[model samples]
Target: MKSLNKVLLGSATLLAAITLAACGKSSSDSTTSDSKTVSGTVKLWVDTTKVPYYKTIVKDFNKEYPDVKVTVTQSPNGSANAKTDVGKDPSKAADVFEVANDQLGSMANQGYINPLSPAATKAVKKNNVAVASEAVTWDGKMYGYPTSQQAQTLYYNKAKLSADDVKTWAGLTAKGVVATDFTNAYNFYPVFLSAGTYLYGKNGETLKGTDANTAAGVAAMTWFAQQKSNKGVMQTSNALNQLKSGNAAATLDGPWDSANIKKILGDDFAVAPYPTINVGGKDVQMQAFLGVGCFAVNSNTATKNQKAAATLAQYVTNKKSQLVVYKHSGAIPVDKAAQASSTVASDPVAKAVITMSQEGYSTIMPKMTQMATFWNLSAPLINGAYTGSIPAAQYQAKLDTFVSAISKAN
Candidate 1:
């Protein structure tokens, strides 16, 4: 992995340098190395899970722009006061912070972020699409640049079903081979969504909890309960391992798993968009939670520093960097032009992921008070239902009511 990271960096040295140097600083400072050099450091906070990828990006960035140093800090996502620590002290805050997009709305509302000015708007708009930019905008204001895209997909072992064989859920089930990481929040949502059910509804512009207790919704939930037998027959494990090995015939997953599938299953893998269902005579699409790892400017910073932070954010998410992100990291490039490359379209793994991303829509991950606690409760509850210990009708009634009450208060 280290050698692969270095190879990617060396291949793109000049491009990385040009990108980092162009992001202006919010304040002017003297540089002893060269008078014309930009002089300032950008403190970046990233989730520790992503440190491996970011380290390479940072190393290559530093080589090109020695005048602009980036201090990369890793903080665990589980830290109790992580957000509070950054929110309270500008001195301790990262000039660029990457958090889940569901948290972006509340944080931006709290005055924690600086709004993207016209320059950023132009830069991102030219490179990305409205769907890719979804998470970065709140209340009509753009605040972040999208880092990657995800969509639910039905990944199958080509040995089991060709592209022509398993096109629908019935075909999938008839094969008596289907599995999922029934434990994960994002991956399981597709099973429910494929049955024409949803956790929330948009009443005009406002999002409201609805349809969770409806007949169709309960039936969808029941289908998942029935899948436990299928799970056992298919030899289920965690989605990563299950899909990586060719033991499981099919599993629902996101674009992030594309490379791992290739690494594990080799040439025997294929992916297709999850099937749809008719709701009220209209075909409603499944909505997964979309998020962005954005470069955020600290609002508390001096104006000059803030401006520079914005520039860095823009450059890092530009077409060139996005290409690197797509090629090496296996992340879907936010830049639409990057998708047009023959390399992206011709590569089997990338082709499957790009197709899924293009057709997908996303819901915001829940971030209100007690939301994490609710997840704690929901995971086991949902798992128990999937494993058939809990009856679907009874479980749905209890779970829906509990979640509704929690949503109201939180």
Candidate 2:
């Protein structure tokens, strides 16, 4: 791993040399001239698991820009901690780093990452899915190139319930065998979303909590309350163990669980979009919070290296590189062409997620800092609702309080 001192020293030395050369030149003139001859050692941070795929991408990138070299480093914690790591020192941060979409807003707010250059922005728009593209945009500016799309899907035991039987919450509950961590806001959020509840207003750009007091919100809460009595719904610590032991017919989860679930269920393991839930006697398809993986540039990198950093970011997210990532890791490709390819279309999990993305049934996880408060306030409410501590009659009031608290905090 490169130390912060080395990173800062390299950037300072490079910037000082560039400064002397452009002493009499305008910033715009310097930028234009540098773009044509952009060449430098771009430090790239990739998830430890994806380092091999990125190494392959670097090899391919070298074919187009032989003068530029990319140094790939493995980030043990993956993109989840990228914001904090980069924030510690933007000048010392990796020139290019992979991050989850939810980090974009915080990173941009803190000046840790740069806005995408015009060419980079255009490439992202043209190649990636709309939701993936939208997830990387913060305050109307594109910050990163999307690499993959991630969202939870229904993983079930085919022998216990047919595909049709798992389409609705009522139908699945009737089978008397379902398991999920009800306390987890992420796992249970679909119940509220299916009933048209939202965590924020203005398409998640603002932090006005859901109208939990509304008829829709109350109805959703009522249904969640009923789950407590559903003997079929296990409340164990290891829900996956319940499925593995044949005690549960299905579980709500994501692609990351696919490998282990498949190992346990073999040919019986299957995945589909979340089932519809009954809200006020009406069936609505559950909506999942979508997460996107992306690559962003360090805003404080040497000016001469910014264009090269953008080039490298764009290169790794292109269709070809996306296909490589899909092959190595089971991550769903955000590139339209790569997603449409037979390789992706043939995979059941990838196909189901792609369908959900195309149909616009998923919500992008909000990247705003206010989300921290939303999660904190909503978790207790969800737990209370599930355990019957928060009665159905008080669901509205509780939701209202939650919204007010978060609004005030934000």
Q: Which candidate gets the maximum lDDT versus the true structure? A: 2
What TM-score, over all chains together, does every model reach?
0.76, 0.88
lDDT of each: 0.53, 0.71
State model 2's lDDT: 0.71
lDDT of 2 at 24: 14
Local accuracy of candidate 2 as per-residue lDDT tens digits, 1-410: 11111110000001111111111112221121233355777899988777887898899888877778789998645677787788776677788898888778887777676565444565568766777778888888777778888777888888878888888877887874888876777666656777777766646677655565578777878877878998767776677899888899888767666678888889898888877876788878877777788887777767667667766777787788888877877788888788889988899898777766654467777787776676777667877888999987788788778768767633
Q: Compared to the true structure, candidate 2 yields what TM-score? A: 0.88
> For residues 124-232, what per-residue lDDT tens digits would candidate 1 score against the true structure?
5666755556556666666566665555567778877777555655556666366665566555544444455444443111234545556655665665576676533
- Residue 92 in model 1: lDDT: 60
